[model samples]
Target: MFRKIRILLLLVVLLFVALGTWRSDSRLASWAYVTRVAVYPVAADDSPTTAQFIRELDAASFAAIENWLQREVKRYRQTQQASVQIRLGAEIKTLPPGLPNAPNTLDIMLWSLKLRWWAYRQEDGENIKPHIQIFVLFHDAKRHVGAALPHSIGMRKGKIGVIHAFASPEQTGQNAVIITHELLHLFGATDKYDFATLQPVYPQGYAEPERLPLLPQTLAEIMGGRIPVSRERAEIPKDLSVTRIGPTTAEEIGLLAP
Candidate 1:
């Protein structure tokens, strides 16, 4: 009789623990999630131009990016009555060395754990604890730079990401677009563009699929490749001004009910 009682007690405790964990995870996924993000700049290349560009990095450089996020949240809230927000934390220094440039699945998990520990140790008490960390690595224009890990989003412990771009004043606006793209990936948004043809998909990818003439789209969907110039062609927007979140993306990110 005592053995049976002990087994029952163990099961009861396990059930309670599972319930508590589920409730906590549900709260994080709610519409009121206000995620805090920190952006850090690093010179990927050792060239003089890249070094100088990294030196010019400041909080002001990301102001437009922050503003764009605010506007997007506000727009969605007004239309769908969802109250999600993105709080941009202060710009921090580059992360420590030894982080993998091209991490595999195991490397990603290990790197995320190391990054969270490193960030917490670097905090000076004045800075807010970020829910997400974005490491922006700047490279020279001569170097071909086209790699941002969408898989790095929404890791265990915390959300972490990386963006690689050219180190030039002219590329700042375009870089902001890329940053915003990766930011959405952290919130469960998937890509809407085709990998083979690099064109935005139909219906879900189109910003205004209900329009009479769907040949030319006025705005680019945030998850899509770019604004559609034709049924089969699209062009990258110069900045976030020409980008807007589509209904599919908003629903995926919990900003709208499906």
Candidate 2:
């Protein structure tokens, strides 16, 4: 009877040890949460008719932004083979310029650190506050009149990787790329395009782990943003190539991956 009891106790301890090891090694250990986005209204000075027009445009812009975000989440999931699912919320109220130095000049910028933290804390369990990212598009005109403007992500570490954009609704199409670009920045992905020359930034080691090419210039990689290739032939740049990454890049940064 004593020997049997000892054997059972030892088995229980070993089971717990194995469970702990599995949990530690599991790639899906850190549960992936959904991203919630809220678009607060900014200060604008236009007539009621103009206001209606702006509202319509804003609605369209919101749709485009949501669609783009979903697309990016899908792409990332495919590449990473991650079990972490991304949930997204609707476009909510727009925030007023809280800072004294902030522009009342039809352009709004969200400092990733500021009051945004409060926004998350204030929420009830009714709304799960996953990592949040804010996207802002600034335009002075009728909200649909201007060239698509280029934006720069602020150097400060961003939560939810906010991108404060300044552009008209007509130019908002390119804003999708900008939004995804900023969000990815939070994930430690570098830009494939160099800001200096306004050209592609093709470093040999740009793609990590998978050695996937960063652009069409080398191999067939989505990081290059090439998709829906023609049925007949897929044209990729000869210079682009991929290499195998053995525990570096994301894993090195401790992104809680599988």
Candidate 3:
């Protein structure tokens, strides 16, 4: 009886802690503030080339990401202008490739908790605490890679995420798009693409749904796929330069006037 009681008490404590963290995260996401994001680069593949690329990663590599976010934030004139500032965090050399690749939602949550603990241990006392943490896992192109399942969780304690991408320099722009996509996920933005077809949904997924031609959209919605070539066909944007935030996405992320 005593053991059961203790277990119940522990569960209650955990529930309270989770509630508190959720409330805090909600305020941060809703408020008009500069979100400080820490980007950690990890070599997911064991290839020497991937290791070399990770070694050479610097702040300059992510310049386009920052520029893209800054431009999007400025475009929203109604709401308090919020901006995202990303800093290259320390390189994680010990993390394995399958750490965050879980089989189910429960397992994913557990992995996120483990990652949060690991990140806390990696930080030095002088480093500022990040509002969001993103781990960019670079895989070697020489090996045949499968689909990426980049994800994020917004919590006061576990505001950490993972993005799997290629290690080649040519993929840097695409990596930025993935990073921004996951970053918005950390702020309560939902995916605007259809899971089955991998195409951006109607209206919300379109950059300008009112365009006369409707097909072959010039600008791709940030939350949507890159290029809406046709009603049935859409492609990923070449870089962050052509990606934009649609009205629905802007409203969901608190960038639009509520």
* Per-prediction TM-score: 0.72, 0.44, 0.85
What does candidate 3's lDDT look like per residue over 1-258, in tens digits?
Answer: 999999999899789768856875776566577778888888886999899998889988887888888888778754555667788888877663344443688786676666666766766333578777788888888785566544433333566667777888998888888888877767767888898888988899888989988888988888885678987888888888889989898888766655
Best by TM-score: 3
Could you give candidate 2's per-residue lDDT for residues 150-227 as a string of tens digits?
343522233433344443554454444455445444445454433453333333223321333423333322232222
Whole-model lDDT per candidate = 0.70, 0.39, 0.77
Which scores better on lDDT, 1 or 3?
Answer: 3
Candidate 3 matches the true fold with a TM-score of: 0.85
- 64-117: candidate 1 lDDT, tens digit per residue: 877787678767776533333343343345544355778799996576557656
The best candidate by lDDT is: 3
Shift in Å, residue 217, candidate 2: 7.0
- Pairs of residues at least 3 apart in sequence or in different chains that clash in candidate 3: 226-237
Q: The CA-based lDDT of model 1 is what?
A: 0.70
Pull out the clashing pairs in model 1: none
Residue 229 CA displacement from its true place in model 3, Å: 0.2
Better of 1 and 2 by lDDT: 1
